[model samples]
Target: MNQDRILLEETFYVLTKKNSVFRVRLTRKGLSLIKESDNQEKKQTIPTRDIIGCKCLRSRKSTTSCSCQSLPRGSLKVVEENSGEQDENDISAYLYIYAYILQNTKSGSCKRERTIITLRFRSFDKYEDNNKEAKRWRNTIKQLIKGEQAQNETPDTPIMHKINEQRKLLVLCNPKSGPGRGKAIFQDKVVPILQEAEIPYDLHITKHANYAREFVRTCNIYQWSGIVL
Candidate 1:
């Protein structure tokens, strides 16, 4: 199995909260959003590492959060009578991809800014049917974010072992570095980010002098994807 290979491919008609339209590609490297306007395709690729979380939702006809009524011009109709095959409200299902991509600041430096990609599913008339497809995308995206399940592997497979758990990061913190502020700073600034990204980690607090150095010298560093100091 080639890790670099695209496990699954999907083409989506994505609508943002601001009514922006873009073409989306789900690949191992990143989620590419290419904008087409005036017969031009301006492309921007959001790195897969920047993606944080994703969700699949089925909006009720009454909710304003993401109703089909919010769709822009020439978008799919929410309800179509396909020989009465749909038994419900014929609502649309939505998949939301959350990411923190880098944006250039006015100060000429780059900072991460949160962005969302929303896709509406109306291929099926029934809400349940539409939502099922949304969930398939959500699940696969989550696997990609976590670097967990492989394309051909089942959800129940011990996939981390197949990849040797190389996705996890090892954090070596000095509890005494900031004279009691070190732990506080890491918890306040770093832990939230790690948790939000669903990134697994092994934290080791230095108990004595040269603790981080000794651990690095003796430990098999390859076990960790990266060492965080």
Candidate 2:
């Protein structure tokens, strides 16, 4: 009895960087990317275990307005030419998926290669509406990733993907923590650990004394998932 259910599915055009169109779907197992052009269909599946992290980003601004017309199907050259031509009025949300896949090296060994899949979702009249959809997908993907990790760590642990907040971590770094080694400590020690754990954090360097304290006092703690000092 194969009981894998499709959680979410959407057909999106114009992958920002790659400029390819795809219909993406999510299941409990993995993400399926399906591309079809000129009656030829292709599919690539990224196992949930390979995906490290995913993030949703809002576009800055575009001078040229973007519209989905007859996309020159399978033509990379045309796609690249018009990729950056987006309208300032377009309120689009971008979703970035990070995964590591094995690649054959010239040295006759396999190496883990990081690939980022950027998805641009838009076409709605309202920005909020588009962002909401993007966030929904982000939340689902994040929870699935976390739930798998939790299961691996403890077989008997109860996994709750619904409760994990997709909030940025506020990191306060002291430049003088070790008289001069604070930067090194953060880069060499803290960063690698955070990356491996797949925690998204925003870094802030304290310049004057009590800077972090004063900032936290006035800043909204609700904006952050957690604070790290």
Q: lDDT of each structure?
A: 0.70, 0.70
Q: Lowest-scoring 10 consecutive residues by lDDT in candidate 2?
A: 73-82
Residue 135 CA displacement from its true place in model 2, Å: 0.5
TM-score of 2: 0.57
lDDT, candidate 1, 73-159, per-residue tens: 444323223434333454577777778898899999999997777787777767678788887877777777777775545456556
lDDT tens digits, residue span 1-229, model 2 = 1215677889876464367779988876788889888999898878877887776665444333554443343322212113464333546776778888888999999987776677778868776788778788877787677763321133454554543458879999998998778878999877865774468888999999999999999989888888999
Q: State each candidate's clash count.
A: 0, 4
Which stretches of model 1 miss by more than 4 angstroms? 1-11, 17-21, 60-90, 152-229
Candidate 1: residue 158 lDDT (0-100): 57
lDDT of 2: 0.70
